[model samples]
Target: MNQWSGVNALCYYLAYILEIYLGFSQSIALILASVAFTQYAVFSWPPYFYIDRIGRRRTVIWSSVGCAACMAIIAGCLLNSSYTTSAVAVAFMFLFLDCFTMGILPVSWSYSAEVQPLRVRNKATAVGVFSHWMSNFVVVMVTPIGLNSIGGNYFWIWAIICASFVPLTYFFGVETSGRSLEQIDQMFFEHPRWLMGVEADCTKVVKQTAEDEEMRHKAYAKYDGFDQKEKHVEVVHHEEAK
Candidate 1:
């Protein structure tokens, strides 16, 4: 999620950098930025439908790799400092944003929420959200400083981070795409690190159970007065029968 935040924060300043640093005209930079936005919106979803089909872990890892490669290309262009390289860098930035939207944006929340146990899921989600926002804040605050101090080479730091995330995800990422929350809990309990092969079983029963429990809790909390009234009515009926 920090990677998601960081990359997104960088994108806000990219047009300015392209215009000033890369010597692009304002109109050209605006066009590139608009194209980037279109790419972002277009690719942000549809991959989510395949999260189960393609497997979440693989999707995330490969997406990280793709982003890393894009970053590397962009960094290379900046390092070389030519008009051609600048154009290539602009293209790579669009590609990087596409990869981020497709892979990281969709799964970031679902993956975090799904991995947590039911009892603490809400708390976990809150923490996840906080962390995500915090990451965004830090990236937004630091990016300008980094850009000023280090110039285009600042992207190399993100590229390395993206590359590192790939292995970290592969080794630690649990397969929870097709499993029930209960199954996910059990898998974490038993293995805690990995799952084996071809597991896309639907989670209908588990989903129903969770929903029913949630409804029961809500109903009980809302109807304490009704419960007391029913009890009093039963007592009166018993007295009348006596």
Candidate 2:
């Protein structure tokens, strides 16, 4: 989570930092930042609609792969000293923004919200936000210093971070795309394995709940009749005694 969140948070700052390290003009930096932001805004939500259709886990996994690849390419561009490397790096930066916004940005929040029970969801979401911001804070603080110290090599660390997310997501990611919140809760209740990637059956759960309610209603009606009969028998017996 921090891997992508931190990268997304600190990436804009890189526009200015790169001006110094890569010796690019401020005009070019501003243009790159503008283009990246525009692409981010345009591509972010459209792909999100497909999250349910294609499944959340697959979207995130594939997007993470794209982000890692972009980071690697950006790092390689930085290592090269040709004039064309600047343009290529800018292109990869745009790719990074697209990939991050499309998958990591929305999934991080939605996935956290879906996995938690309704009773504690607000508090859990708060914690999730805090963790996310804390990661951003750390990255924001460390990035400029790291960029100065390591130059282009720092991006390889981010590439590795992005790559590591793929397996972690595949192993532990719960598919909540078509499942209800209660069904997700039950999934965790029944199988507490954090590493198990399972999709919930909300239809079956809802059907079973309705069946249980119907059975309870019938039992209550029968019990009510039995109580009334007992009361009538007691009344008759009391009058005979009198």
* Cα lDDT of model 2 by residue, 83-111, tens digit: 68877887787788888888877788788
Compared with the true structure, model 2 gives a TM-score of: 0.78
lDDT of each: 0.76, 0.75
lDDT of 2: 0.75
Give all TM-scores, in the order shown. Answer: 0.78, 0.78
**RMSD (CA, angstroms), candidate 1:** 6.3
Give per-candidate clash totals: 0, 0
Candidate 1 lDDT tens digits, 111-195: 8989889999999999999988888878888888988888878888888888987777665666666565777888666653243
Kindly report which residue stretches of model 2 are placed more than 4 angstroms away from their true locations once superposed.
2-6, 198-242
